[model samples]
Target: MPMSITLPGPAPWGFRITGGRDFGKPITVSKVTEQGKAAMGDLRPGDIIVTINGESAAEMLNVEAQNKIKQSPGQLRLQVERWVLMGHLCNVNLVIPNRPLAPQNCRCLHPKPIPLHPNPSLAPRPRRCSHPCSSHPAPPPIPGALMLPSPPGPVR
Candidate 1:
């Protein structure tokens, strides 16, 4: 889901927007300075700009998008497609934590809820484990879980 983040600012916006014709990819947030306006807002590194002040980001050139943001009155309302939803925007890796890759109830480590679901904010990830599997049954998998597609092959 696209989020509308209101960045209260004057200029610079404390962030950078890259991509579009200048970069040969969709308009994406290339950087967010720490403790900056954009950092304080919901903007992240891989967020793809869907709209800027209700203007279609996909339709505008990079320079045009920058101009729109630059000339904004006070606040900038950005409609951004999150990396989690768009899947690896700006060549960023979808981090797979060091959790057990084993199946549920397989005498492996306790399964942790994969927070990379529809809304990651809902599920906070557990801390990393230093030891190996505890020789216990893995927690039951979540129904309708996002499973990685099997390797390509002709099903015999």
Candidate 2:
């Protein structure tokens, strides 16, 4: 589900939307000015812009999206898709007997292509609980999932 975010307008909405001129690329929220006009509006980096002022963003080029943002009247209404790291890319099953906790064969579940971070760090292999009671190791992480802040703590 896309979220609708409205911010007071005029020039300098305090955020920027960026995407390549490539036809299928997504118009993503590239940057947000901290403590600026858009900061309090609940906008975040990497949110995909779906519509601008009720106009389909997919129909416009990157330049057009920039123009629409700059031309907002009183308020800027944007429909954006938030990116979810977990439960977005693939399904993970930790208990694969005789094999690595996470396998590289997981398939991308999304039909539309999502943009990745410009520089993604490789995630370390998941840790298995040495406690004998736990039969399986931790679930494997996606390739660049090092961004995960902390473990979920004791999975049962």
Candidate 3:
């Protein structure tokens, strides 16, 4: 299994952005960080980061411009929109494995298409107990063990 990592802030991928608080401002690579290389794994540079872990990145920025707003500081699932020379392209999902910067001036690429099928459902089952507690008490004492405890009546 791959070890997970957390981003301190939202890092920018290579790409030009349009429309937003920073509308008309072009988001470029090598400006974000020294490790400005496009994510070698899934998302490439210039791909706009849209969301992290299902939460909309734009919405998150609206709430707080800090990258720390992520519920947990760890590997983040990102949703982004890739702008191609052609018209708008498909929304891509990316993963941020380290600390990222706040995307105050950036915009989420776009949301990806979700499949129509609903998730599989299963009935809830009772959980098993491993320790002794309320539901199950200790076993009763042995019957004959109590009969042997009495002492002689003080040398009467």
lDDT of 2 by residue, 40-145 (tens): 8977777778898998887678888988899788899998865333222234532221222332344432111222222223322334433343333343444432
Which wins on lDDT, candidate 2 or candidate 3? 2
Candidate 3 residues lying further than 4 Å off, grouped into runs, are: 1-38, 60-66, 69-72, 86-156
Error of 1 at 142 (Å): 20
> Candidate 3 local accuracy as lDDT?
0.28
| Overall lDDT per candidate, in order of appearance | 0.58, 0.57, 0.28
lDDT by residue (1-156, candidate 3, tens digit) is 111222433344322223222443222111133344234333443444455455544533322323323343444454544322100112322211111112122223321221111111321222322333223111222232111111112100
Worst 10 residues of 2 by lDDT: 147-156
Q: What is the lDDT of residue 38 in candidate 1?
A: 94
How many clashes would you count in candidate 2? 0
TM-score of 2: 0.55
In model 2, residue pairs whose N, Cα or C atoms come closer than 3 Å (at least 3 residues apart or on different chains), thus clashing, are none
Q: Of 1 and 3, which scores higher on lDDT?
A: 1
The lDDT-based order of candidates, best leading, equals 1, 2, 3
Which candidate, 1 or 2, would have the higher lDDT against the true structure?
1
